[model samples]
Target: MGSRRTFSRRLGVPGRAGVALFAAGLGLMSPFAAAPASAQTADAPAGTWATPPPLGPGDAPPADSGHPDTTYKKKNECVQRSLGQDVKINFRPWGQDYLQLDRAQQIVRAATGSVGGNQKVAVIDTGVTPHPWFQDRVESGGDYVATPDNGAQPGMQDCDGHGTEVAGIIAGNPKDPQVGFIGVAPDARIVSYRQLSENYAKDDSPQQPSAPPSGGTGAPPSGGESQQPPAGGSSNSQLPPSSGGGTGSGSGTAPQQDNKGDSRDLAKQGTAGTLNTLAQIIRGIADTHRAGVINMSVDHCRPGTAPGDIQEGERKVQAAVRYAADNDIVVVAAAGNVSENCPQNDQADPNKPKSIVTPPWFSDDVLSVGAIQEDGGVAPFSVHGPWVGVAAPGTKIVSLDPAEHSNGLANLTIANGNPSPIQGTSFAAPYVAGVAALVRSMFPHMKARDVVKRLKATAQHPAAPGGRDNFVGYGVIDPVAALTANLPGDTGNLSLPKPVVQEAKLPPADGISSTPMIVALAGTGGGVAALLITLFVMHTIRRNRARSSPPTK
Candidate 1:
């Protein structure tokens, strides 16, 4: 965790002594940074932080206006008390896996019957927003935070760029076709679960910047109320109402922006409750067998020796994943973006062991994904773990970011777009999840366990291993290899043929001269003339006999 070097891929060669590299400049920073928990790094490029277009009084459209679903109202009310999007933070890109991602996609198409036909794949992460990639891609799963009254909607609006970016990777279609960074199965449906909506997406909570940090030691809240902070704490900040018009810093003047639904009572410990509700919804989907695959790009890091504690909220959430799998759904997760300084029993923790990811205790069904560099090496930021199942492209990987509609595929290649270069395990998990959908699409009847086996078996080994590596588990998932590699076809349908009829013909009369029938008839007529003369003689004899008999009488 000492020397920092920028490798082409996020996770570089596994055993080559990884130097934990932190890209705080990108939107992703260590959880321990001193800045406001919601603050984006100043190092991010101009466009990401470029003043969002002057949001007029009606500029930031109401979350429920155009959508027919009523769930928007419920979710908006639930998250109104939290911090909203801060103009200062730089929105990070999903990073540089575009080329490899494209290749992987091709392989999926060749293998799967069709790219995820109408199947909904839900990504439960920080809130997501509508981007060109997903402009028409999402359907409402209900905004869990924006309005709390209901729990379903069509648009997956992202206030924080994180969730939207992850969703885009899972199912985004680029505006510019010239740059091919389309998702693995762009046609597949997407469900956005607003899990990381707290400080990240909608934290209107009064910020007493001067208050001391408690490091999350407070007791869990009782009942479904917002838990109030200890006494002497300042109240939550009131966000300037959203403005409809004006540019730069001036956009905060609008009145409607401030009316972002109703605030929840802070006395209730509602974060956990909110999560439980989200989990129940997910479990319900699994029970109904709705989504073919579910991608969770969010993870809670737990310290060593803390046997069962991982965010009291996460413990409940992971159980939901198990429940989903019991009903035959596939759950995929990010290992985490905390590889830079993974703290171990007090030393630099250089054992290069499996202490990185969470829900970390082995879950056979969960496919823990670690990030890898373009050179087929482990990304510097990727967390390693024993539970790791496979790897996908996660370095400087290009993906959809909702905050700035600027395209990642185009921005990465060109210099002009608000290029906030990004890297993390968040980008990696979707690639695999998308591929999993492809696998399921092609082999619709294959069990989740069988699909896992095919993915592992098809994965090609990278330059550094006899088998699986700590950095690139089973090597960067070879989509072409994974999809085409000995996949047995499903035998659910077979078409039988109908019976056929044949006509018959008689051979020409045996030896009748083989001439015309008229000629044959004329040849037989000469024989009939001789028979006529014989009949005349017999007639004359009968007449003479009759005359003689009359005389005798």
Candidate 2:
């Protein structure tokens, strides 16, 4: 893979890359580039990259918004809010209404707790906080963003609420009647992997640095404006005791005002470094053998670029996904929140080849999910394309909230203490992931591909032109059907079907004849007989004349 430039797109935020890394000052190095001969030896780790010096304040890359900022008003409000003279209050959690939770509950009850027993789902996103609703189901895998000198914390800590929300949807306990929030796979276990940094949302100032570094010669580069994180994080609710604080990297800190001279230079380094770090994290996840299904609600987009163009960072991620698939781990990702037809045209460059967002578009092995509304229509912001595997409810999804109000941002209070309603494909992907956990738990013998096939085969088709269309793919997933129905070719044996051989019918013994051939043969015989008769008559006439008077001549 040549080093191709790429962009990221947030799940909920429109028109912005989900995760942006800038290597403006530092040369853009490929995260998966082969190390020099001097750096490698037979004893070294198989996939280790040459370690660069720990980034300092001067080297801190500027953070881009990878996770959606939950502080803002949710795109589509799940809970209805009542307006009083002075106070606004949220009434109830309406996610159940749109999700048709009763149907899912009925299926679970019938199954008698047979679903999601020991199935392990790896959530690769922001860190997930262990909420009371989880009931000790959430497990810490490791933090990939932390370095020894970056003041980063270990374990899964969601400074932004994205990871916790996604985990809640996948495995939050349904037994918590007080909270009234139920996860699709309530019994499933969650393994959290913090692939993104805590300060993923921070942005640098746009103005160029006023001065060069104290010892350096050149002026610092200008920085881009900060964008909001994608959709589907816990609103600015308080972080629970179980929910750890920020990764302790300078993530929570506001952009510096006095360090204008080196801010841009540092921000670019940070951004570029983050990409390399993310690739490493994905590779680590692939190496973990215990993970059954990996839910990645993150998406990358290069605004104004075609979809199929593979970027260097994206190539590394794709390779990681392939590694996971080879290990029998199923990977599910968001289809992105952009409204365009993915892997299609780039109106920005009409003549360029159609390309799609990364990770989800990386391979067929990755199950890419799109968002659908309560009315069984595709979400307005949901990205549509041939790559979408299935659709799930993403609009106004109500899930767990962090207990401590650390950020003091926008917090909506629903039942179960600050549970907020979020909407995006980020939330949609987890729905499928939860169902995938159920399938894996029930059918432990099935391969990853067979599991995905069962899910798609059992999905409920919407009333579209075709049973399956690009907008919703195979339509919204039917959890009950997926769990109970026996799909075609689902037998454990991997043998191919026997070829059906039809016996050929032989022609009649006399031989076959066509009307045109028979007519032509009869015509030829009649012509020959007429010519012979004419010649005989002429010969007879000549003989009679010779005998009468022409005998002498």
Candidate 3:
């Protein structure tokens, strides 16, 4: 059955037609493709040029699908330790872990003379906890969701652990030097926006007596699709009938009783709701003139299959991205999670190539970050297409996990908590976002285009047919090069002088005559005018002096 399944599975671009067309188009259009390798100087590693198979992390296996009636409480437990602030962790081989980051830091430190002093980054994902990793590192960016008043509600906190993991990568600070984590920017502040609601539908609803505590990790993988909460199950009295259309009043709500239903209920797309909330936050940021970066670790793809045109949600997102750019804000989004397929198979219509980050990465204004493996290769599970701006570390990456899944251990707190190694393009995006904040901090007046250009120019190209590959864009981001790279932005308005026409011949003495008439006449007129004015002024002064002297006498 397995052999037949493998044989039956169609791979590569559907047929050779697509490949032939793409190659022909490239030959006719791409100037870089024709440029000689020696002239270009840099290159990606040599490999047979092959279109990587469409891939995705797809559905996790049945064994990994189920979740506990309640989330694991230990996952949320913070481990307090007496370790000092600056300890080196042997998280990986010392040579690999610290060498690159330390070197990069040194370069940035030398360039800027400090970590970002007071720049804020909005982590638009699951809420971050008050850990030392984020100690003195966050401001109360109001929670966007109204029903869930506090961080305890869904979309107010992290339940799946994806957002928390990404946060730590961008800003975690573990106490243990030997076996914990340190973020890319420890001092930079974070504003958490819980994009994914915590009260995601679960399969089982534990009764009052049986309901597990808030911070408990439920039994691992009991069956297919974890326990889901019923739609409109929790506190309907506090929530509006439809969380769409218009803004609802934000009122305080309490912990609702545990009620379980299908997981699909949680998958509802409130594009309007999400965009409205995002707009409000962005407006606030702009109104206050707060210059910072917006870190988006989530992205949806092009919508429309057997239906009408794409939804307004995508448009709203595009507008928000444009708003961020126009307001001098840096917007960063994840390339996306990849299952094993080449392009993701749209659950809506598996037959078409209908997938990539939504609004095509909000019209490419936002920097779309892809995932790279430990070997600096594109992660097998990373979705790659034209939208990719750059690649960053996204493999078995260790970062902050929520307390419910952090497992009472501090070391585990920094480790990838999920079953299949919490690696995705989501984590990679924040690394770049942190770097952007660093760039904005150093070059306060830099625009979005300037930041993007410098990042690409200074990126360390991966070894290959190697300039910018679809998979890794320009290549891994070089923080050191970025900080020191002299990429210039728009320098407002300066006019250049026109070139003078120096003639080979003087034409004639007539040309000289014309020049003499203008010059001599102008000089004589100026001299006569100056003499008359001087005499008149002297006479008037003498008369006034004589009258004043008589009076004085």
Supply the global lDDT for candidate 1.
Answer: 0.47
Give the TM-score comparing model 2 with the true structure, all chains together.
0.56
Model 2 lDDT at residue 527: 93
Which candidate number would show the highest TM-score if scored against the true structure?
3
In the order shown, what is each candidate's alpha-carbon RMSD? Answer: 25.8, 17.4, 24.4
Per-residue lDDT of 1-553 in model 3, one digit per residue for the tens?
A: 4544443344333345455655655663442243334213222122211111221344111111111212221112121111111112344422126226666655656756766656778776545554445665655554543223233433334433445555666656554566435667656777766544433332233542232244322211100111111111111222222111000111111111111100111123321124434444555554554547877765554422432233454544555566667777777777765432224423432223345444224424567777777776677656655456777876555554343323211211111112123355766787888788777776777777667656766677644343565566667888777776544343212123556998697555643447778999999999999999999999999999888885544
Better of 1 and 3 by TM-score: 3
Per residue, candidate 1 scores C-alpha lDDT tens digits across 309-408 of 2443444455666666767788787765552234221224222232424433224556767776667667665665434567876655445534333333
Q: Which ten residues in a row are the worst by lDDT in model 2?
A: 218-227
Please give the range of 10 consecutive residues that has the lowest summed lDDT in model 1: 224-233
Give the per-residue lDDT digits (tens) of candidate 2, residues 1-553. 1122223232342233223333321222431223233211101122212111121343221232333222111111111111111121122234454556557656755655644757888887656756666778888776654321213234355534456767878987746344455777887888886655323323344652332111101101111101011112233333222222111111122221121111111112232123444445455656656579989876664433432344555555666666677678888988766522233332342223243555665435578888877677777667655556788987655556532222111122222122223467777898899888877776677898888777776777644423455567666787777766754477453234566998898876885668879899899999999999999999999989878875454
TM-score for each prediction?
A: 0.54, 0.56, 0.57
Runs in model 1 with CA error above 4 Å?
Answer: 1-113, 148-155, 198-278, 306-314, 339-356, 360-362, 404-420, 462-466, 487-553
Judged by lDDT, which candidate is best? 2
Q: What is residue 441's positional error in candidate 2, in angstroms?
A: 1.2
